[model samples]
Target: MTKEQQAQLSQQGVEALDKLLKETVENRVLPATYFGVTGPEGELYYSCAGEKVFGKPEAGQVDPETTVQLFSMTKFVTSLAALQLVEQGKIAVDDPSVIEKHLPELWAQSIITGWTDDGEPQLVPRKNPLTLRHLLTHTSGLGYAFLRPDVLERYEKKEGLKGFLEANIGVEGYVRPLLFEPGTHYAYGTGVDWAGILVMRLTGQTLDEYFHEHIFGPLGIGKEEITFLPTEQVKERLQSMAARTSATKGHIILHPGWRNVAKMTPEMIGLQSGGAGMVGTLRAYLKFLAGILKCQQPGGIISPQTFELVFSDQMPEGKQPRKDLADFLEFMGVTDKQQTEGKVTHSLGLCYLANGSDDGPLPGSARWSGVAKTHYFVDPKAGIAAICGTNIMEEVPTQFLEVYSKFQRTVYDNLVQSKL
Candidate 1:
C-alpha cells in the first residue's frame, strides 16, 4: 500500500479491529486498547489500557498517543539499539576483548557451561570469548531458571536474583555467570539485557537516554502519553496500562507496584531492556515496524543489514525442530511436554514461526505475545500485519493463536477467493 493507504489502514483496520475489541471486552476482560499501524506487508504497534480504551477517542484523551509498557517486545527495540551500535563500529558483534571493557565482573564469575546429550548438565571451558553478537543472538549460554524449582534454587543461591537485578539493571549485574559457554546453546536469559548495558557503555548513555537520542527521537512518538518514562511520572500512564489488564487478573505475574499505580517505587536503573521493557502506543510501535518492513537500505531506525541479523534464526546448530517447537508450545502451555523433550518447531527471538512443519502460525509470519496477552505480527512475504491487545490474560491464552491464525487465513483466502 502507498504511504497514504498505510496511514489510512490504521483508520480502516480499526473497523475490523474494533470488532476484535468488542469480542475481547464482552468476555469481561479488563479495559484494553490497540494503537496499530498496518503497512502493505508489515506493521508496528503498541498497546495500553486507557479509560474507555479503543472504544472511542475521548476528549483530550490522545489514546493513540499514550505509551504503554511493551514488556518483552522491548527485545525488538533493544535488538535494534545494539545493531545500531554495531553499524557505527562502536561495538563488534562477536568480539571478546570488548567484553571486559564493558563488564569486568562477568569475565570472571561465569563458568563456561552447557547441557550434555544425555540430558545431564555439563560444563566446558569456553572455547571462544562471548561477544555482543552472542548476546544479541541469545546464544551466549545465559539461562533463567525461575520457571523451574531445583534450577531456580541453584540459580538464586549461585547467581542471586535480587542481587543480580540490582547490580545489573541492564548489563553490569547480569553479566556475572555464564549459564553455558558462548555460542554453544540458546537459553534466552539476560543476554539481551547485557546487550542493553552494552549499548549504554559503548555510547556513554543510559538506556532511556540512548533510546530517546537514537530511536524515539526519530519516530515522533511520545506525542501523547509518555512511555519508558520513569515510574514517578507514570501515574497517568499506569492508570492507562491498568485498564487493559483484565485477562490475566488471576494468573499474570506483573511488576509488584502495578496494582497501586500511585504508590509505585523507583528503581536505580530505569533502563530500557531488550528482553522485557518499553512502553509505547500500538500506532507508534507499528510505525517502527513499518520503517523496518519497508527498509530498502542500510539506515531506517536500524541498518537493513542489522535488521536481517536480528530476524535470522539465532538457535544453536543441530536439534530436532520438534524439540524447540515443543519448548515454544510448552512455554505457551500448548503441549504436555517439556522443552528438552519437545519438538524444534518454532524460531526464537521474536521472529516468525516456520510453519512448524505445517502446524504453527503459517510459514513466513513472525509474532510475539506479551506477558499480558499483547500480540503483534510481521508478515513480510504476504504483506500483512496484525496486533491484538487485552488487559486480561486467558486461562488458556494460547487459544488466541488459533483466533488470529484464522484472521490471517481469512485475509489470505479472501484475497485469493476474489481472484478466482
Candidate 2:
C-alpha cells in the first residue's frame, strides 16, 4: 500500500494485462471482455477489450456501460438481499424453522438416496431441518441440474420439469430433491433462489423491487444499470455471448444463446431465479460489490457484525467437500481443492475458498463466477475487489483460466509487491 509499491504494482499490472489483452484480440480466451477493480475507497481500474459480438465488425467494442448476463454472479446480489433481511431482524441466519415457516411447500422435500433397482428414483426424508443459514451457505441441500447432470437425470423423471433457458423463471426448477442432507455438504446450488423467494414473501415485494428499494436506491444506482430479465432496452446494451471454438487458440464463434438472449421477451421475466436471472453493466455491478466491500467498514449496506459474519467461514463443522464432489466440481470448470487444500471453507454469503496464506488470493477472500466465464473476487485484507468477465459460454475454459490466473497473480503481486 506504499506509494512506491502502488507505482510498481500499476506498472506490473499494465504489463501483465497488456500481454493478456493481445491474447484476447487473438481470441485467446474470449471475443469480448470487460473487467473492473474497486476497493472501499472507490474505483481503481476499469477496462474493456474485444468486440461486442463475435463476427459482427460493425457492432462495437466492450466498455464500462456494456451489459452482460451475470449468470451465477447473480447469487452475490441475492446473498446481499438475504443478509439485509437478517440485518433487519426479520430473518435469523441460524434458525432452522425460518424456511419452513415462510415457505411451507419446501417442507415436503426429499434427499436423493440413490437410484432404485429398476432405475427408478430413490428418495429419503431429510433428518436435519433446512435453515436460512443453510440456504445462504449452500448447505440447504439444493442444487442446479446443469452443473450436476446426475441430479439432472433424477429431476428429468419428474413431470412438468421445463428447461429454464428460455422459459419462465421459478422455484420449480430448484424444487428437485436435495443432493444430501441439509447442513451436511458443500454444493453449489439454488439455495439463494429460495432465499430470494423468502425476501419476496416477507416483504411482499418482488426481488427486483426489494433490491431497488434497499440495496440499489440507497447506494445511488439507477434501475437501468441492473435488469433481472432482459427487456428490449437491456438487450440493446448487452455484449453478445461468444462461444469458445478451440482450446489452444481460444477461437471465436457465435453461439445460439446470444440470439436467444437477444430475443428474450417480458414473458420470460416471470419467477426470477435469484440464482441466475440477472444482468448488468460492469461498473454498476462493481458499485454493488463496492457496497459489500464497504460493509467491511462502518456505515455501509449491512452492519459491521453482519459483514464479518458474511465473510467468515460457514462450512459444515470440521468437514470439507468429499473427494468425489470435489472432482465433479473441478470437472464442471469450478476449481475445488477441499481435499488437497488446507482448511478449505465457504462463507455464508460468498464462496470462500482458501485462506490466502502463501501466494495468490489473500486468506479469507471470497469469489465466484458465472456460466459464461464471468468471474469476481473480493479480498478484504488486500482492500481490493476485482471482476473479470467475458460473454463466453462454458465456465472457466482452460485458456480463460490461463488469462484469469495471470490477472489474479498480477493483482496480488502488485498489492504485495515486495514478493517480487
Candidate 3:
C-alpha cells in the first residue's frame, strides 16, 4: 500500500479504537482506560477515556501521560534485564549453578509434598536444580499462596505466617515451599522476583537503578515516566484503581485493596517486587514496547541471537511442563480454535502463539497481561506492538474483555490486514 493509503487506514483504525474506549468508559466497564499501538519505528496510534479518579470530575481524564500501576507487566522489564545479563555472559539461562551461586536461598527451596495428619506441611528436597530458564518460563514450581488456599491457610493459621500482601517485607516475602519440583510444571509466582534478586546480586544494582542505566537510558525514557518508586510529580498524575461491585453493577468503586496499598510507605513495601512493582505512563511503556519490536531487526536493544532466544519457546520437549504451558495458554484465553499443545508455548517472558488466528495477533506473537486488566502483545510477524492499560482490580469483566479483543482486531484489520 502507498504511504498515503496506509496513513488513511491507520487514522481510521485510531478512530475505531477511540470510539471503543469512550464507549467502554461511558458504559462503566472501566473507570479509566488507555490504549496504544506501535511498530518498529514509533507509535501508530494512541487514545484514552474516562476520569483519572472514578466519580470525580475534577480529577481529569486519564491520558497517555497518566501514571498507573503496571503490576505483573513489570515482569517483561525484569525478564529483559536478566536477558541482558545473559548477553553480557554474566549469567546463563540454562545453567542451574549460576542461579545457585547468585541466589542460593531460592535454589535451596524444597517441594511441598502434602499435609500431614496433624496439619503440618510435608516437604521433600528438590531433585532438579533451579535454573534461570525454569524461573523465566514459570516452570520453577513456585506459586502465589492465594492460588493454593490450603497452603495459605496452613501457613497463616497453622504456622502463623503473614498473608502475601502483609508479608511484603523484602525478598523473604516470596520464600515459600515449591508447589512442584523444578522444571516439572508451570506455576506463575515469585520466580521473576527471584530472577530480579539474582540480577541485583550479580550487578550490585537495584532493579530501578539497573533499568535507568540500561533500558531507560538507551530509550530516552525519563525516570518520572516509569519507575519502581513514583516521584511526587508522578504521584500527582497517578490514576486511581477501581473494582466492580458486581458484574451486574456495571460501575466501579475505589478498590479497597488499592486504598490499603496506596497508604504503604516505602519501608512497608520493602522489596521492589520485580514481578509486580513498577508504575509508569502509557506513553513511556509504548516506547519500550516499540524498542522491543525493533529487536526483530538489526541494531536493537539486545543482540539478534539473544532476541531470538527471548522470543523462542524455552520449555523442554516431550516434557510435562510443555503440557502445563499449553494449559496456561488455554486458561488465559489467548488461544484460538486452532490452538493445540504443539501450537502454544511459553517464551522467556511471554506466551508464544505459533499459529495465532486472523482475529487477533498474527502467528509468531508473544503476549501477556497484568493483574489489573492491563494487556500487551508483540507480533514479530506483523511488525507491531500494542498495549491496553487499565486500573481495574479483581477478575477482568466480560464487557472489558470483549472491548479489548475488538480493539486488537480493529488494529490488525486496518494496519496489518489491509497492507496484505
lDDT of 1: 0.53
> For residues 69-135, what per-residue lDDT tens digits would candidate 1 score against the true structure?
5666777677778878778887776678877688665556555344456644444455557777666
Off by over 4 Å in 2: 1-12, 164-166, 245-250, 320-329, 334-342, 357-359, 416-420
Which residue segments of model 3 deviate by more than 4 Å? 1-9, 163-168, 245-250, 256-261, 329-342, 416-420
Which structure among the candidates has the greatest TM-score? 3
Runs with alpha carbons beyond 4 Å of true place in candidate 1: 4-15, 29-37, 40-62, 112-125, 157-176, 223-226, 231-233, 239-262, 265-272, 320-322, 334-349, 354-364, 392-396, 399-420
Cα-lDDT of candidate 2 = 0.72
Candidate scoring better on TM-score of 2 and 3: 3
Against the true structure, what is each candidate's TM-score? Answer: 0.74, 0.89, 0.92
Q: How many angstroms is residue 44 displaced in model 3 relative to the true structure, after the best TM-score fit?
A: 0.4
Predicted candidate 2 versus true structure: per-residue lDDT over 306-368, tens digit per residue: 877767876666454433334545675544344134445567777665556233677778777
lDDT (C-alpha) at residue 360 in model 3: 76
- Tell me how far the alpha carbon of residue 261 in candidate 1 is from the true structure, in angstroms, after superposition: 6.0
The predicted structure with the larger lDDT, 1 or 2, is: 2
Q: Every model's Cα RMSD, please?
A: 6.1, 3.5, 2.9
Query: In model 3, what are the clashing residue pairs, if there are any?
Result: none
Full ranking by lDDT: 3, 2, 1
Whole-model lDDT values for every prediction = 0.53, 0.72, 0.77
